[model samples]
Target: MTPRPAKGGRAPAMSTEQRREMIVRATIPLLIEQGSSVTTRRIAQAAGIGEGTVFRVFTDKEELLDACVAEAMDPGTSLAEIRSIPLDQPLAARLTQAAEALRAHVDRIGAVMGALHATEGRSRAAGRPGTKSPDRQAGMNAATDAIAGLFAPEEDSLRLPPRQLAQLFFGLLFTSSIQESPQDIGPVVDVFLHGALASTG
Candidate 1:
């Protein structure tokens, strides 16, 4: 019965980081489900927070949209690890690894692909050129560098520059429709890397 404690003296809670994390966690699936029009209210509902709280955290819709897009295309795979993949292994093995990696990248950000298609339509209507973002450009650069470093034979002696080869490979990865069979990608990549017609008699 001494000091009677300091009633209501406990410090106010600090949950800013937690709130932000929750918002980010909810953003991806919502974006996936609702396309890019995902409103602040929608995000708040997904995150289980008040609509006002979303605005308190994000300055505007554009800022939040940009953040969500960035997260979607992160490429989760590390550059070093990608470089370490056995590119020099037999062509079949290399192709398998490359196919799996490409699949993984798409799986992680597959939801964005639909949005990208819509964006492309708008850009084309406006006569704008569609291109990869700086981050994606850098990723392409790193991937090509890795390919050149590993499979020197692919373009080392070939007349085409490493960059051109990189472009071809990048296009193959990004543009080919998601075929049901993985084997389909292999020959497609081959036709891309090697000519469709073979010289063998």
Candidate 2:
């Protein structure tokens, strides 16, 4: 007979989504520690699941890795918080908060992408050898859309369209993530909100 999936000598108390999230979370440290050589066995052990259950949840190693990457990169929770920001708050305060939020999200994804590149993305991803993984691209688009929404309410005050603002904001975030010139989002947001030209009045 097929055996039950056990946890602490009892069945695991988790739904499919919860189980999948747990396994993906467990995969994070392994992906960092083991690189491309990370095995399903290790993930199963970390997740406290039977090896067969891992396959049942994810079709194969590539699929599992994709799920892990997607989960790690998803900005849903962060976006929700950004969405709930009081629209009546001062524009500088709102934008500063948004910049900090995006910075934190980018930092996390940067680390995960670094690890993934070491695992496999350094070679064949999809288009060119150095192109971003599909999951990363999707995550980027999602983040841009969410940030764009944050700017939409202030379209009347912005010199540029909300979408354009979103693009520039992301550009600043991507640039700052790689370089040491600017220490944090504070300066970036200042220039983004105030512009380079000095006040005439």
Candidate 3:
């Protein structure tokens, strides 16, 4: 017999790993609502676990914050879902679907992006160019490539250097304090993907 999914459906069983995941899930909302000044006791309370458990799993607040940042930025939406969308679909429609999926999966990605941008700016001001860890840079590279593939088969318009544009997109997503509504970001990303300056002038 096929095994049943977790309580939230498709999330697997509520093992220790699941508990850790749940705790991380709880951390973001708390961080957003309360700001980064959140204490371990508060995080544990929000996670509905004993305060000691938080320490047991994560060595300290910095470790927990790192975990929170990692989880918050991850695109929870599966690439398979995007691939399943009909190939014949119009570029606008496909792009809209992808944006919506991104919005849903990493709703808090904006916050994380903002943090990264701030760090980058500070590093630049301090004369530490591209100081982000090798691992982070690698992850950013991978995310860029994956994002680029979403615009396949429409080479003339959608095609851009994935590596370079990925840097721009990541910078824009993180640096700009744009509180764009769903409708806004769709066309904005389109213009960005297809050269707005050229179209306007």
Candidate 4:
């Protein structure tokens, strides 16, 4: 028979990266809700780990906030979600789903950056200048390509190429103040598919 271990044995240890990921995941919502004012103690409570665990994973709160910023900016998750949209759906419905995913992506970046700006006096950069860093440009290109995939099936019916339409779609999304309702995306998709001109028929 195998020997029994002590009743009060400690839990198995997690690797450093695993611990950091856990803490960062827990902290993101708190940062969105409480901004930079969220405390390490609170983060520890949220992760169900001791306060010192966070310090062991991250050198300090600022370093942890930096990790959060990096996480918020990474487009991998959003791209995966957009790619998973079923292609058999109607063109409008597909685009709307993509739009919603992109919008949520933008919102996450905004919330984290807004929180950082509030406490760090950091300036939120504006506009797509020619000087965008290579990584930023690459991410944008990936997002555009993902959006373009939604238009692939309708290519023969489209007046413009899928890539160009994708760029135009991004333009509309950035300019329009879309809300968290299916109704809001309807008009945006309609405008993109048709036009802003009133029907004269």
Candidate 5:
């Protein structure tokens, strides 16, 4: 369940990580629906805390956004499921399952990259000189690495590199537009399993 601040204008004493996680989790929906336009006021309302509490927990709005990206990137919930993929399954079957899982993950964090991008459009966020923050890059790299681990067991039969395939698959997932999406992801998986080349015999 979503967390709410304690009653009587008092917040329960929460550790640093606890407060950060609560704020990030509360902000997740706002980020998805509103992108970078989400404000601390909205986050505060969602979190059931005073607006000042947000700054107390984070140095500034940029830091809050940074933490949100990190939270979104963490595979803690899904890592176990990915690792549990049955090795005996056919490569295609396994990959399709991976695709489905990845799709759900992408949907969960829809437009998160866009939010980060839009935020940076104003100016570079803390912790990096580039358009994207190091935290964002770290999160992305961690997600790709976890996905690659899923493909490792089947690497012996894969012509394309597992990690490369993981990266490409996620790239497609991330950039996919909701309105432009097909009726289902099956066709996308089909294309991934078999690309532009066709049988000419």
Candidate 6:
């Protein structure tokens, strides 16, 4: 028979996967703030679970760090944000929104990886392969496709096809040193939409 709750009610039971997700979510901020030095006691406190529970979900801290890196690198959230931009919005507005989302996605990956590298002194985070990995390539393709969708409504006005335009736009984003602020990003979008040369009357 299942044991009854004490005076106060107990939280709902979580499956092994659910517990792992909970621990990872709680640990991400700590990893950013403390890097690989973040201790299991702190993680348990943050997760509101016993220290042993963390080990039950992951073999060790290295495994947990790998999970955090995976979450940071995943492009699903950014793609959803880009895809949700309304097609009715002007081309510039749509691209600006997409740019912001993509920049934030890149920033997140950098932050998590930077923190881990600072403490670990490794070229790449444990368990994450090179960018040439199939999973990483697939994520890059998905992000480009999502950005390409933004140009669909303005296909006639554009000189190049939407997919090619997207590849260029994405390249510009990754190659250039863009700040997080919208003000900084707006001019870049403007330059992309219109040539750098001044238009004469």
Q: Which candidate should be chosen as best, given lDDT against the real structure?
A: 6
Which residue pairs come into collision in candidate 4?
A: none
Q: Rate the local accuracy (lDDT) of all candidates.
A: 0.62, 0.70, 0.60, 0.82, 0.69, 0.83
What digit string (tens of lDDT, one per residue) describes model 2 on residues 1-201?
223779678765677777778788898778766765788998999988899989888777777666666655667767776777777887666766766666666566666667778766422233233334556667677767777777766788778887788888878766664442234556777787787787999
**Residue range 1-201, candidate 5, lDDT tens digits:** 434578986657888778888899898788866777788999999999999999998887777776776566555566556667787886666656666666666555546766656655222234444325446566567667767776777788888887898898778755655333334665665667787577687
Q: Estimated TM-score per prediction?
A: 0.54, 0.66, 0.57, 0.82, 0.58, 0.86
* Runs of candidate 4 exceeding 4 Å displacement: 1-12, 121-134, 177-182
Give a tens-digit lDDT track for model 3, residues 135-198: 5455555555655665566655544564565456656654556565576666556766565566
TM-score of 3: 0.57
Off by over 4 Å in 1: 1-22, 37-53, 74-81, 84-89, 103-110, 113-136, 150-165, 171-181, 192-195, 198-201
After TM-score superposition, the amount by which residue 27's alpha carbon in candidate 2 deviates from its true location, in angstroms, is 1.2
Identify the candidate with maximal TM-score.
Answer: 6
Worst 10 residues of 2 by lDDT: 122-131
Model 2 residue runs over 4 Å out of place are 1-17, 119-142, 152-155, 176-183, 197-201
What local lDDT score does residue 78 receive in model 2, on the 0 to 100 scale? 71
Q: Tell me the tens digit of each residue's lDDT in model 4 across 61-108.
A: 867777777778789889999999999999999998898888888888
The deviation in Å at residue 75 for candidate 2 is 3.8
> Candidate 1, residue 78: CA error in Å?
7.3
State the number of backbone clashes in model 6.
0
lDDT of 4 at 140: 85
Report the lDDT of model 5 for residue 185.
64
lDDT of 1 by residue, 111-173 (tens): 654654554411111222343353767666776666555455465466677666656766776
RMSD of each: 9.1, 6.0, 7.4, 6.2, 5.9, 4.6
Model 6 lDDT on a 0 to 1 scale: 0.83
